[model samples]
Target chain A: MLIFIGLGLNDEKDITQRGIEAAKKSEEIFVELYTSPMPNINIQRLEDTIGKKIRVLSREDLEEKSKTLLELARRCVVAILTPGDPMVATTHLALRLQAEQMGIKTRVIHGPSIVSAAPSFAGLHVYRFGPPTTIPHPSPSYRPTSFYNTITQNQARGLHTLLLLDVNHEKKCYMTIPQAIEQLLEIDKEKILENRILVGIARVGSNKPELR
Target chain B: MLIFIGLGLNDEKDITQRGIEAAKKSEEIFVELYTSPMPNINIQRLEDTIGKKIRVLSREDLEEKSKTLLELARRCVVAILTPGDPMVATTHLALRLQAEQMGIKTRVIHGPSIVSAAPSFAGLHVYRFGPPTTIPHPSPSYRPTSFYNTITQNQARGLHTLLLLDVNHEKKCYMTIPQAIEQLLEIDKEKILENRILVGIARVGSNKPELR
Candidate 1:
């Protein structure tokens, strides 16, 4: 059996009770925190809470060596813990497909995700939000502008856009709200983004969550 | 203080640990289950689990008699329990805004939402989903065909559409997957929806969740 559990947002305690139960029952646990920047995540605290030693999987480990993890699931109950809702990322979905192909039964324990949390915290109606977009930090040779187009399309429909900032956990780099705004300004050659109200949220699902 | 607590997708146990803590600490609890159809929702069971007598709110109560609820919040900690994520409904968002305007503090305890769960269970990529649409049961002189248009718009962008079937809790009428698909077929005069694959999920977040 292969179980995919979401760790929710921020710290260890944000995990749902159902998630904790699954973690306790699983014979093997693998956590992937590198996909997103969870600033308050403490591996030690999470391990202590679940009473299990979790093998942390890097991006390469998940993409290239997933068969090793699948092999374990073939024998015993294996849980893959991820920040936010599991399978929100394409890679995680692909991994689940691979597990299914190998005749492993799979289940998902959903958690509170930023996709819904952001708008709720911002006092915005979730129904009015169009499909969300992501803003990635530009590289020297390549910069994607599809996010800008998505924002414009949503704005034209009188809908709000939730822009997710890019994260590189390996390099300890995260794109801040200010950096995201700056990128938007740089990409707004058509001047459609001018004077638009933007809400910035930090540490959502935490006790002292901040919104501006 | 007023807190909006999401009960998640299915039953009382689907409420997160954080949500349970908030419910325990709350002086008064109000639940509105009319907005969505949660097949496993049992008000008596939920009240028993929380160890509190919950005042159930109807649409008229929430929209017309909101001040009465807000008055309770002014004096004590009041928690409003909602199915799925609390603020997903626009009416809930409006109530929160009203509370804020009346000098009441509000917070949200996020939970597992169908917005994320539907795609995850369907084995479809979450990022590939466009803005979600609702399929309401047709009434004389009030057949809404916009949902069909929305589906076509999403399909044009090579994205999938998550269609939420409308429910009338007071009438105990929930739109089934067959009803929704039949409605879609009737409204697709443009013939854009023919032969498109539709995934139906039942009892999500339950022990016997079924997806096809």
Candidate 2:
């Protein structure tokens, strides 16, 4: 059996009781956190809470070498923990699908996610928020303008756009709100957001997440 | 001070440790369930875990007479609990905004919401899901068909639509998946959804929610 659990946002305590129980029942517990950032997360605290050492998997470990991980699950109970809700990142979704295809039982233990908290704490009606988009770090070869296009489309439809800033896991840096705005402006030929009052929320799922 | 805590899907243990801590810190805890349904929720278990009685509020109490609830928050620490992630419904958003306007501090403790879990458990990519649309119960005066429009727009954008079935609080009946699909077919004039393989997810946040 393979159980995918979300560790919620921010710190170790953000995990739900259901998640903790699942982790306890698993013969192997694995955590792979490169997909998202929670600056205050303490890995040690999470290990203590689950009462076992969590095998920390790198992005390559999960994405490229997930076959080995699945092999473990095929034989015994295994849990894969991620930041935010599990499977929001397609890598986890791919793993879940692969597991099921291999005839392995899979379950998901839900946790707090920024998808809900962003609208909730920002006081924006959830229904008004359109499909969320991420402002990616543009390279000369991979400068995608789709995120900008998504914002303009949502604005045209009279909806609010939820912007998620990209993360640079290797450099241990997160894309800042200002940095995202600068990136957006570079590709915004229509100037749709130039005069719009866009709300920026930070530290979601934390005790004191703020909206600006 | 007022804290909006989400109890998550299914049962009391679905609440994160962060949520439970916030409940324990509050002088008064109130739960409003009319907005959504969790058929397996154990109220007594929730009370026992928090070591306090939870004041249950109806739609009338929360929507019509929230002033009394806000008044209490102005003087003491208060926590309002909800079925899904708090403030997904605009009612909780209104109350939180009111408390903030009254100079009372407000915080949110997000839980496992169907918004995230539905996509996760169903093997659907969260980013592909567009602005969620709800199938509202139609009264002769309130028979709105805008949900069909939202789904069509999402399909045009090459996006997946996340359909939230309506909760009829007075009748204590949640709009079933088949009922929602039947409602959709009734208004699908252009045959947009008639041939589409729509996925239905039920009992999300529960121990055993199924996807079809």
Candidate 3:
């Protein structure tokens, strides 16, 4: 059996009791950090919390050599740990499809996600959010124009956008609110528009989530 | 202090460990079910799990009679329990704004939500989803036109639509997926589309989440 356990958001304690139980019961555990960042806790912290040693997997290991994990699922309980909710990224889905194709039983232990948590934590209405857009750092060669377009369209309709700060795979960058605000302001100046209402949330799912 | 605790997608166990601790420490606990539906768990089960009795509130009660709750918050720790993530609905946002206006301190406890969970659980990519649209039962005056528009648009772009079912306040109606699918098919026929892929999920946070 393959159990995809969501480590919730932020820390090791963010995991549900059921998810913890599943992780403990599993024969082998693998933590994938490529999907989303769980910056609060480390592999050792997770291992201590769940009482199991977790082997970390990269994008290459998951996408290229996933058959070994699938084979492990056939013999024993294999738990795949992910930040926030598991399966938010397509790699997780592709793995699930591979598991299904191989006839391995699979289960997803749901966890708290920022998609829902962000709006709630920031005191924003979900219905008022048209769509969420990710704003990346402006590059000379690659400018994410579509993201700006989505923000403008949603703004015109009086909808809030969940501006996800871009992650640079090459530089190991987690874009901060200040950087995002700067980018938004730059876009506003270039496009000749005013700043819409933006909410900045940090450390969501923690006891003290900072909102500004 | 008023703490808004998201009860996540299912029973009391769906809450984070921090949320459970907050509930235990709270002097008064209240549950709001207007924004989202409770998945297969009753007040008794919740009280049993959390070891605290929770008073239930409606939209009107949370919005209109909120002074009493705020007063309780001022005196002691009060938890506003909600299904899904708190502040997903406008009512929660309004309540938060009101609390801010009255100089009442408020905190939010994040939870798993159906917004992203619907697609995540269904093995659909969250980023590919366009602006999500809700589907309501066709009425004489106000039919669910946006439902069809969103579905068709998402299909055209090879994206998925996480269609939230409508909730009837008077009858307390939680529209099931079968009903939603039928409505979609009817609307799709009018638009001359056929054989589109659709996924339906029920009681997502529960142990036995029905998926089709």
Candidate 4:
């Protein structure tokens, strides 16, 4: 059995009771933090809470060495934990499809995701928000501007947009709200966002979560 | 102090550990089921899990009589329970604003929301989903076609749309998947959805949740 569990927004206590139970019962547990990284996540504290030791997996481990995980899952209960809701990332969805093709049963245990939490924390109605977009850190040779088009399209429809900041867990680089805003401004040289209001939320699911 | 807590997608166990702690600490707990309803939710079971008596509130109770709840919140910790993520609905956002205007402190405890869960269950990428829309049970003189337009807009961008089925908790009238599909077909006489695949998710966050 292959179980995909979400670690929610931040730290240990954010996981649901069902997630905890699944973690405790799993024969092998692996966590991948590349997709979404919690600001205050402590693997040791989460291990203490679930009473299980978790092996951290790099992106390559899941992308290239998935056969090994699938082999273990085919024989025993193997749980893979992802930050926020599982399967939201296409890589996880692809992993599930691969596991099923190999005759492994799969299940997803949902958890609090920033997709919903960000708008909620910003006091924006979820229904009024358009498709969320991620602002990737631009490379010298290649800068993507599709996210800007998405925001423009949403704004044209009078809908709010949730801009998820890009993260590179391997480099310990997380995008700050100010940096994201600067990128947006650079992308929108037309000054379309000059009159727009942007809400910056930090450390969601933490006790001192801030929204501005 | 007023804290809005999300009950998550299904039963009592679906709520995060933080939600349980907030419920236990609240001097008074009120749950409004009009916005979203969980099929397998048992009030008694939830009460047992949280060790607190929950008072059920109607839409009017929150809309018109919010002063009463806000008054109690000013004196003690009051928690308003919502199915899925709190503040997704504009009514809850308005209530929170009102509370702040009256000098009441407010916070939100995030939970698993269908906005993310539905796409994940359907094996669709979350970023590929456009703004979500709701299909209400059309009344004789009040048929709304905005949701259909939203779907059309999303389709134009090669994005999937998450259509929420409307429910009337006061009448115990929850819209079924078939009913929702039929409504969509009726609203889109242009047959925009004739060739499109619609994914129906039921009993999400339950032990026997089904997706097709």
Q: lDDT for every model?
A: 0.85, 0.85, 0.78, 0.88
DockQ rank order: 2, 4, 1, 3
Please give the distance, in angstroms, between residue B209's alpha carbon in candidate 1 and its true position after superposition: 2.3
Which candidate model has the greater lDDT, 1 or 3? 1
The segments of candidate 3 whose C-alpha lies over 4 angstroms from its true place after superposition are A42-49, A137-144, A156-158, A168-171, A184-192, B58-60, B138-146, B149-159, B169-172, B185-193
User: On residues B1-212, what C-alpha lDDT tens digit does candidate 1 reach at each position?
Assistant: 99999888877767776788789899999988888877677889778878999988999989999899999999999999998888888878999999999999998888888888888778876667778889998999899888887888889878788999988888998999999988988888888888888899988777788888
DockQ of each: 0.59, 0.81, 0.58, 0.81
Lowest summed lDDT across 10 adjacent residues in model 2 chain A is found at A184-193
Error of 1 at B138 (Å): 0.9
Clash pairs for candidate 2: none
Ranking by TM-score, best first? Answer: 2, 4, 1, 3
As a TM-score, model 4 comes out at: 0.96
TM-score pick, better of 2 and 3: 2
For model 4, the local distance difference test gives 0.88
Candidate 4: tens digits of C-alpha lDDT, residues B1-212 = 99999888887777888898889999999888788887677889889988999999999989998889899999999999998889787888999999999999999999999888888878988778888988887889999998999899889988889999988888898889999887887778888888778888888777677988
Residue pairs with clashing backbones, model 4? none
Where does candidate 4 chain A have its weakest 10-residue lDDT segment?
A10-19
- For model 2, the docking class works out as high
